[model samples]
Every structure is written in structure tokens, then in C-alpha cells.
Target: MTSDPDTLWRRCAHLGRVLLPLVDQEPGRKADRHENLRTWGIDTVVGERLMEIFAALAAHAVVIDSSVPTAQFDALPVRTVAEAATSKRDFELLAGLPDSFADVRDEQAVQLFRLSAYEGGQASRRLFQLSREVRHSLIVLAEHPLLPCPTCADVLRRATEANLPK
Candidate 1:
């Protein structure tokens, strides 16, 4: 979508919900968790889990009135969301998001996703890359449009309590 600063939040939030989990899991597991288990990119376990979530969202979004986009959604490359142009626009909008309504405009969560896959320039992604479960919990505080609320860190823990594995 061509982002407008006023309505840019929806795009940023949508991207945050969609991409943060993937970016966080781009590396199979965190270095702290398994210092020895250093997989550079997605592995079977992470890939399968992501596919499961993607499939579930695609299949069941219609069941409830949700924003999972059963019909009107982009078929563009995943990298499109991380494009420098869009990311720059989204990044600027975050500061103007109605921060008073923390429930709606969570700047941190959006930035966690937007900066994680920064393109065309060097951006520091240290904070978003959490080293511990507690820190990860902070990122998941806001419920995402595409994914359910209170998400746990894929690097540290998976939500076993959920009905389906994510």
C-alpha cells in the first residue's frame, strides 16, 4: 500500500504483526539459548511452524471477522514489506501514532519488525533482538492484527498453551 502518514499506522502495525515473528526466527534459535546451535537461516522446525501459522491465518480468518486478508492482500515478495522506502515511511509514522492509546499504536512492536529487516542502509537492531524471555515478552504485549496477542519469543519459548502450535 502507498502509505499515508495519517493512515500509515495500519500498515506499520500490519507489517509488525506479520514480519516480526519471521525476522526474529530468521536465525533458527538465539545464540544465548543454544550457544552451540547456531543455524544461520530458517531450519525445518522454524519453517514448518511459520507455514503452519500462515496456513491457519489464510484458512480460518473468514471464520471470524479478522484482518488476516482472505481476499484483498498483496502477493508481492515478502521483501516488499521490508523495502527501504516503505520502512522509512512506516518509521516516521510511528512517532505520530496516538501513543496515548497504547492498545492501538504500539511503536515498539512496529519498530521491532520494521528495523529487523532494514534494507539499503545500516540500522541498529540490537534491542529488538532480545536476549531473554522477559524482554521478548515486552514486544508481544500488543495484540497484532494478523496474529493473536501476548506472543512469546520463538527464540526462547513457544506458546504450548495455545490450541494449535504457532
Candidate 2:
């Protein structure tokens, strides 16, 4: 099937790629803005937010790219994090984060950014591979041909289930 221009997987890939360079000296961001975060620095909770975002995005990429029709049936695609509804609450957990950054002192904001950058780097370095492996099992389980993969349905399910709003 011809992919829609605005699928969640596509949005995730686009956003991830944009944020990818923040974790490194890369192409996405302009040098100075990137420098702004780099010049500020120590890191994980914040790094972890982007990590959850990226992880969900990655899982979406896999299942969608896997071309498994059954898997695709379970995916949810919405424009903004506010509208996103999934079993994994990671995206929504950080729902207010961006606004929080806007209100906080630059120092605090940078710290949050730094932590996010650190986790993003960790994810890139594969330091988080073991957890991904654990998640992989859920994806496998969801492949039963009848039911949807809740894991893929909500990539951040395990990571943020605890933090989900009551």
C-alpha cells in the first residue's frame, strides 16, 4: 500500500531525525541552537523523554516496515502528542514537558534537555539494548495473527506505564 504522507511512523521518523542531532554534532539543527544545548550540560530523566519518544517511533517503524498487515492494524496515528492515544503513555507523560521548558529557568530547561540528550545518546550507543530486547518479546507475542501487538500499539507501555496518569 502507498504510505500516507502523515502516518505516525512517518511523523516519528521525521521528529526523531530532527532530534537525533541534538544528541550529537550532526546535521538537523543549526550550529548555534545545537551549541546552546551542548554548551549546557550532565544528564537521564530528560534524556529519557526523548528516548521514549524515539523508542515508540522505532517500534512503529519496525512493525510498519515489517509490512505485516496484521501488525499494521494495531497502529495509531495522530498529529500531536495531545491527540495521541496508545497503551504506552510515554508521549503523553511528557505532554506538559515542552510547556514546562518554556516556563522554567534556562538552567533547569538545559538540565532537562541534557538528560534527554544523554538518554538519546545511550539509545544510539545501544546501551539500552537489553530493554529493547525485553520489549521485543511483546511485539512477538502480538504477532498472533488475531490480536494486535500492544507493545507496538504503545511503544512506551512498559517504560511509562507506571507514570501514566491515574
Candidate 3:
């Protein structure tokens, strides 16, 4: 028997709650953690979860737009306000994303992931410098007041702990 939309939605929400924290973990451990998530069949679950969140948000927008009378809608600008709020929420969610979860909205994470990969397996001076730069970017993004993405904040803390003088 096929699952109802509400059942599927709840599953997605549960998966997101579980996976998002893992995704917010240490950057250095991200590749390995992602591999484990994939092996445990959680990676696809998380991706599907994120998609469900987005779909629900879109449906809410549609419903709000439809509910408004056309003449009053134009005067109230409800649609525009809703779109702007959704856009900001989307950006905040993306700003919190981990390096392993690359999407169209996650360009910064992708760039940092590539930089870290390029510096791999070689204990050169440049590797340390590159790591520092990546960490700095993560911290700045995490602390950004406007968005203040909690995932970024978590990762930034992890990166700081990892890079501290030993």
C-alpha cells in the first residue's frame, strides 16, 4: 500500500532532524561522515527530507496566493511579501548547510570542499594556510547576523576546535 502524503512528510521531517546535525559536524570529518551516512542509507533520506520541506513551503505559498481575492491581492501585495519571506528562509537554511550537501544554493560550501580536497594528502605549509582560510570563511558565514544559520555555527565551532593549537 502507498503511504499517504502526511506519513511521507513526517518521515521526511524526522530524517531532516537526524541528518542535519550530522551535516553540521566537523568539516574535516565531513567526507568520512557522509560516506557513513550513505552506507547507512541516510544520505538519500536527508536529501528527500530537504526536498519535502521545500515542497511544503511552495505549497503554502500557492495556497496563500489562491486564497486572496484578485482585486484585493494586487492592493495588499501579499504574494510579494510571502515570496520575499520564503526567499530569506531558504537562504538561511542554505547558509546552515554542511559541505557534504551541495545544492544550487550551497556554492560557498562547495568551494570550501573543493579547496580542502585540493590540499589533501600533502603536509605542506600551504595546506595549513588553506585550512585557516576555510575556517575563517566558515566562522564569518556562521556569525553573519542577518542569516545566523545554526548549522554553520555548529560547523564553525567544530572547525575551531579542530584547528586550535595543540
Best by lDDT: 2
Answer with 1 or 3, whichever has the higher lDDT: 3
Question: CA lDDT, every prediction?
Answer: 0.30, 0.34, 0.34
- Pitting candidate 2 against candidate 3, the one with the higher lDDT is 2
Residues 63-119 of candidate 3 have per-residue lDDT tens digits of 233453222321322223223324433323223222342234333333433343355
Candidate 2 local lDDT, 34-58, one digit each (tens): 3433433313334334333444344
Top-down TM-score ranking: 2, 1, 3
Tell me the TM-score of each prediction against the true structure.
0.27, 0.30, 0.20
Candidate 2 lDDT at 62 equals 41
lDDT of 1 by residue, 1-166 (tens): 2223333333333333433343344354334323321232434443333322222222122111223332222332222222222223323323333333233324343444345435423222221222122123223322333544322232113322232222
Query: What ranges in model 2 sit over 4 Å off?
Result: 10-42, 68-166
Clashing pairs in 1: none
Q: Model 3: how far is 72 from its true place, Å?
A: 42
Candidate whose TM-score is highest: 2
Model 1: lDDT equals 0.30
